[model samples]
Target: MEIYNNHKRLYIAALLLFLALTLYAALIPAYKAQNDNAPLPNSKPLSEQEALGKAVFVKEGCVACHTQQVRNVEMDKFWGERPSVASDYARNKRPDIWRNTANLMGSERTGPDLTNIGKRQPGKEWHLIHLFQPRSVVAQSIMPAYPWLFEIKERAAAADVTVQVPEEYRKNIKGDIVATEDALNLVAYLQSLKQVSLPDGRPVPKFLYPKQSTPDLKGMGTQTEDAGLDGASLYAANCQACHQQNGEGLPGAFPALKGSSIVTDADPKALITVIMKGYNGRVKEGFAEMPPIGVNNNLKPEEITAIINHERTSWGNNASKVTVDEVKAVLAEIGK
Candidate 1:
């Protein structure tokens, strides 16, 4: 009561109280968090180019649309192998002396989470084209283009990494599109954003509220031949992103699958081989080298068969449907 009546005494008491609250509420927990969370052993620090890319990402407001975090939910599984943990971010450091390390694990996911985008879509060419015009690769994509990140050149120099923009999206532009240093760095940062593997024997966290397992729509399951797989669904999940729903791939970047000879061939070996081993021979044709989708996605024989059947039957191509047994034989022969 006396202290309350005395202004100087009351001020001293309030200051002490505030100090105690700050110590208990902030300082202590902050110290504990720093001690408890260590970077995963396999986690690598961002390289110089990747750091520049991150700065570009921040500068360009990429965090406004995209998120880096993968939540612990079954729906988020497609974005990452496992739920993201604190260790996933432990390696993050400040951008430089002038800036603090931004909490880049963004809040709103206006776009797909990039927790493991490096693994999901690793092709540099694809990223470059997508950056130039998202609609070129994904017709339904609503992402805005970053044309400022590229330059139009009358003819690309030998050292230039040219982007293969499709004709329609080119808007009658007269020159080849070359990625600027900022664009390349931004992609490097994106491509570096892979989910590191947990150290040996560490129990991985499970996604919460697991959805009832559906048919292997993405071909990452062990469905039987008679399981009534949806070939169209398979195509949409695993193939449509690059090949397009119409089977007409992005011009100058992805080859058309609509009237592909490989899809209609009597022997499915060529198609299956490409799917399994991946293909780069078409790079000379201005198309990006295809990653081994079948192997990378861990597609089962039945799932591969379904996708093959869909591609063969759809887009006005009536190639005979390949059986699951045939797919199995092909995969086995290729040692996949």
Candidate 2:
């Protein structure tokens, strides 16, 4: 009886030991992953203005609509060049008041992911106008306008940044809409939300997930024929965000491509020059200058010609097609 009792106690001890080992085995990898993926050394620290802007962003509930995380999935290719990794968000710090001062990986994506917004859209002027009234920039955008962040002035001061609201939306306002400091701060914060690249020599970590089966499709064999890249498609991809689909840009914001003398110019050099180097000169008062698209976007000569040809052809304008060699010549002549 004594031997049997001792044997039973030994069995219980062994079972407990086995259970503890199993738990440790399950948790050690997670802890190691957290330790291995430290934030990059050159990760940008937010400025005072940007920190304040982050407070405003939280206060305004912008996180409710926008997600900062770029998940690893085939469908998320549009959000960023690669799926977001742990290190990408390692630098993010939450507000001081929260006990969990670590992550702001939003719960849902009512708006587009902002992980690479700084690189994707670097135009401060565009951000200002969009913040003042999203509908003016994106015709079908469901974003709520934050008009309170702006003030109506009879004429904008030299120091004030004027936001170009469309006439239809500005009918009630008496003067130019100037962005407040808060608005500027918010823009700064938005610009700071860039995803830094992983450190050198570090391979992207693979996330383990359950295997998913391909979905059933009824008409896989009847898919439409492939349409090769065209000038129109090129324009739609690059220029339509500002110039708009109809080529009628928002009045006083982006100049309209439709019937514009620049688009229909006999000498394509000027257009090529603008494409190679961004136009930032104020052609008219109370309007923002155009940023150099070619250098900023790194558009190749062939791509520039395609965009120029598309802009000239679309919107009922008749202009000679620009060749790749012509674009190259202009780019060299202008020293771009």
Best model number under TM-score: 1
TM-score attained by model 1: 0.84
- Summarize candidate 2's per-residue lDDT along 204-244 as a digit string, tens digits: 64434524533433455531211122767767656776777
RMSD (Å) per prediction: 4.0, 8.6
Candidate 1 residue-wise lDDT at 146: 98
The prediction achieving the highest lDDT against the true structure is: 1
Per-residue lDDT over 41-114 for candidate 1, one digit per residue giving the tens place of the 0 to 100 score: 98888899999999999999999989998788878877887889999988887767799755599888989889
Candidate 2: pairs in clash: 278-292
Error of 2 at 282 (Å): 5.6
